[model samples]
Target: MGATGTMNDAWLTLREVRAGDRVAVLSPSWAAPAHYPQVHEQAMDRLRERLGLEPVEFPTTRRTTTPRERAADVNAAFADPSIRAILSTIGGDDQITMTPYLDARPVRADPKPFLGFSDNTNLLSWLAYHRVPAVHGGSTQISIGPGPAPHPLHLDSLRLALSGGDHVLEVPTQISEVGHRWDHPRALTDRPESYPAEPWSWAGPSRAVTGRLWGGCLEILSWVLAVGRFVRPVEEYQGGVLLLETSEELPSPHEVYRMLRLLGERGLLAAFDALVWGRPIVDDERMVPDPVVASRARAAYREQVLRAVAEYHEDMVVVQDVDCGHTLPQHLLPFGEQITVDGVNQRVTAHFRRAPRP
Candidate 1:
């Protein structure tokens, strides 16, 4: 794929990840490996066994490190030629703090495919700021740690994006809203219950909308919005698909409405050609234990999302109930690659850049 017309930057080429390659593991936000050694080791073992990739930890991978130190780890990963890719252990609350400590020069010079999500949005935004396209989903502790295996959809998407191929994303037939508690002994052995999957609900125009996918966890976006860091001018996002999902905190419907309202107020909502809202996960076991109550919560979340779209850009193509967020069976979304939201056909397709290996 050629450079996107909407934004101008020195586009960095990301090489496909190869088997047996050394992948640098870093924690820019939370150091899950530090607190849960057993869980961390299990996840690392899975990566090696299933993907045939060896994970090499940096300073911040195992324990909590200063923001500057974490940023240094990221810098070193990209600058080092031996490390084929960079992966995050997990997400936390304040990754934006690490941005100031990051040096963009080396990152721009030797861009490698960085895979992460949630608070990792800050790093994703930073990479995009330097014209580097990154894989926006996947984490060692969450996406790959729990359960006996990574969800089939998650594994497929990860392979496509990392190995370099165009992938038309499909909604999973089954979805899991809850996760096993890491501290619990049954966490590794127990799997989250799966629910009947829902089809993507399309709103607005019936015509197709295509653009480079952007955006990340909405809560994280709000944090970035507050600092006014890493984000470019509103005009640059003209032809982008806004990919948004709420975190496990499960913000109320009113909060979701208000956040989207804030985006609209800033003239940010109307710029995107299309929007993909991930299926919100109702994972709080204590808060909403009753299945009926949880269902109501999910419905309310959807209604609020629809209201926000109607208020901001009525003509914009929007797809809701997508399986790309905090929910189990997460699919990787390329941060700056082309995606097509077919409203008429009720489908979304991701076109990964088939670039030759560097």
Candidate 2:
């Protein structure tokens, strides 16, 4: 199950951050901060107060800019010795365009934890290709700004990501698919409405599987695979753990199936020993307001996922509806670190390693 001459051959651990260290908060994709300055400011405050880290912004951090400009900012953050970590303001649809402009030298020379999700998968995958381990979730806008405070689980995992330690992923009792619009005043002070989360559904043998992590938002990953620049050979993923989640854009169940089917066709799906499917955001109060319809949609998503898994790798351990991805109370999974999926006890333990000084 070892890979050679591929991204998995040598994974670099990121240097952990300390309190009062400077962290670059950039807009590598959409400048959500530009449109919602108040929310962004609130998120900055929380970053300092909760994590004790000073937030620093680059030129494009709060403004819409070209992909090249965004990539320049990211490069600058990585090149700077004072910046211990980097966080994206939010994710957007066009981060894939930033790939060509990104300078891998800076990231490889000084690997610091880069935390983000959704379209930031573009950056995460690029970092992974260069052997730098990153974090898969932790958008400042969605994770820290909108809620009354950062969700405890999110904050805890984020803290561990920045520092260093082992964390057992917890299944949240309640989850929210939608939050108040940043334009709404209550978005600043109130927690989003939530409902009881469905218990995680497990499929496969009652055995434990441990491996390095790969994968991200399913739609963005499809784009990554199509682009074919950041992805490695399918064999590179053998015995690795695959993480998949959908966004609020809500691709249909058939689309989900097609994506997995494409992966299967590419020999990607069967390469992993286990898969962790994040809980999908099925209900949008303003869109699909009917709870019954939302429930059915959720079930259909699970069915399609299992359908694909069975087709590709029947013995692969799968645990769906875990609190990750588009849902609130998300857990920031380490993108290239070792994680254990114990199907017998149904627990996920993430092993976060502290980087050795270069």
Candidate 3:
């Protein structure tokens, strides 16, 4: 490993989902759409019935209206000694607004595993700032909900994340081409549309490198950058694995370029040794658009966006189309931890500096 961050900030690994342990489930921000409760329940059942972990819910877990209430629920969860870990019901677009009032003391004292993605980035970034290793995927609504079956890629990535391991997180190649619906009543049954699986393939891996991992949904990360939290020094990230992915909003290639350009302008782009950029979720805004147009847009992502970042950070090895973000079978990446990016092998793997027992 290259330079590691201060051990002053720490990670508290929670036990994997066990039949009787109480795990806190709360809504970080927005309440998922109406039918999402069933989706959430189904997800809980999967963990309980299959993995044998109890899915505990907090009072504000399903509320749609108050940010303070949501934050309070999170604080209470952290304060409760009965709760061993914290998990998100799903990500919301404005989780940032809700987290401003969060009390960091309990989290710092216990430091148990926290998992979520998308808008959940707000919380994760805060944890990273405090030096807590937060897992960046595994929302109950999507990954565990009404999919035809548990996505192998999602399961494997999540399993490793929850169980803690000396393992390399692999991206699944064959993925569902279609995205799921949040509105259809029957969708609560997990009847998501299926598309052909598109497996992850590596592009440019220059060499093998490892260091503390940091990042989240690209859009959410931009928010963190905009808000100006306690971002780590650029020097703290040299030769480290930097993870990134776009959200369902599907930012245009131009937007992607501008964001990366700003990162570079701030002297932030040149710091990473390797970068993993996830595939943009094409099902929502881009779904109705022409396939030809979408292909062109994707092409623009590879050429315009990825290539532009490469231009500024000339030595950085970048990997594209990784199965993360709003895509199917998402894998959770731990922020403020060590990961190995192999350019030669075209794989990006995450390892724990301190792993929890299964």
Candidate 4:
């Protein structure tokens, strides 16, 4: 299944953010806000103080919400003329069930920036299919909530995306893979310790590939694949940059390989021009608690994923250890927007908003 064409130019223009713009916050998946009101409120404060964006909560933004209720908030937010963007409280495990309740007409008629990752990937995929470009990284609880201030890179990428202009992003020089537990008192006042970043690893030819970017947590992607909900034809994804990352759940190398192989078998893996593999975390309390073991575990996860990808796409360009998913200093990237992967120079630049369509 060769790519049908390039989506790099197919960006769906959405409304721009301005001073006093209202952004809707919805818990489309988990009720993290409900369970962790302190963390949620702190994020809202940052939204107002940091970005000057007013945070508006939906009926289901907090409280033990149902899938239908969550979907309603999403539809309602997009329908509201005042809402400039939609942000998720955090990622959960069962967003696949909420999609059926979503009405695409409002979102399509008035597309706005939708920001999240992991389980929120379901919503991002739906928006992409409707030609609504969405930010595929960032979350209220993690990237925006826990830190004393948002990571500089995350703040910079988000500002550019909301500013409604084209911007080039460089990889973060530092990242924090560890953080205080959400329940810990320091979660609000403290910031995580940071470590120097390893340069992104590039595989395949020393060439460049540019296209619209898609994909999220690999585990949720498997769910999307099995459910056959938003998994479009391989042709629809031709020449797109596939973004994949793991979660704190920390799946084994075998599991990673299995999922990648499944995608390859379906011809999905071959549809993308390149892959941006997020840095895998190995600090799960239950899995690799020892920092030394964690590093080894992450390396094994990378090896397994690369092996599976190579089996299907020998010439496909791949960039590993990108500070995008389940890691600190995450960059909020737009799905279905143009991105250039300079395999030759080991650079990846995502065009948040494309040039005027000819």
Q: Scored by CA lDDT, what does every candidate get?
A: 0.82, 0.88, 0.71, 0.81
- The sequence of per-residue lDDT tens digits that candidate 1 reaches over residues 1-358 is 2334465345667777888988998898999989887778888888898889999999779978789889899989988989988889889998998999888887777667899999998988888877888988889888777777777788888878777877777878777776677887766766677766767777888989888778899999999888987777787788689999999888889999999999998877899979999888776564224567656777898889889888988888988878888887888888877788999888888776645664
| Runs of candidate 2 exceeding 4 Å displacement | 1-8, 286-291, 356-358
User: How well is each residue in 195-274 modelled by candidate 3, as lDDT tens digits?
Assistant: 44444545554688777777788888888888876476666656667788888777888888888888788777777777
TM-score of 2: 0.96
RMSD of 4: 3.1
Rank ordering of all candidates by TM-score, starting from the highest: 2, 1, 4, 3
Residue 270, candidate 3: C-alpha displacement in angstroms: 0.9
Please identify model 3 stretches exceeding 4 Å from their true place.
1-19, 33-35, 171-173, 183-191, 197-205, 285-295, 353-358
Top TM-score prediction, candidate number = 2
Off by over 4 Å in 4: 1-11, 286-291, 354-358
In angstroms, the error of model 3 at 192 is: 3.2
lDDT of 4 at 196: 62
Per-residue lDDT over 1-358 for candidate 2, one digit per residue giving the tens place of the 0 to 100 score: 1236643577777888999999999999999999999899999999999899999999999999999999999999999999999999899999999999988888888889999999998998888877889998899998898868998899999999888899899989877887889988988998988777778889998999998888999999999999998888788788999999999888999999999999999988899999999989876555224667667888999999999998999999999887779888899888988888899999998887877553
Instruction: Give the TM-score of each candidate.
Output: 0.94, 0.96, 0.88, 0.93
Could you arrange the candidates by lDDT from highest to lowest? 2, 1, 4, 3
Clashing residue pairs found in predicted model 1: none
lDDT string for model 4 (1-358, tens) is 1223445434458777876889998889988987888888999999999999999998888877778988989999999988988888888898888999989888877778898999988998877766678888768888788857887888888887776665565667766776778898888888876666666778888889988888888999888878876666787888888999998887888988998999899987899889989988777543215556656776787788789888998888998888888877787777777778889888888777633312
Candidate 2 lDDT for residue 346: 98
Best by lDDT: 2
Question: What is the TM-score of candidate 1?
Answer: 0.94
Colliding residue pairs in candidate 2: none
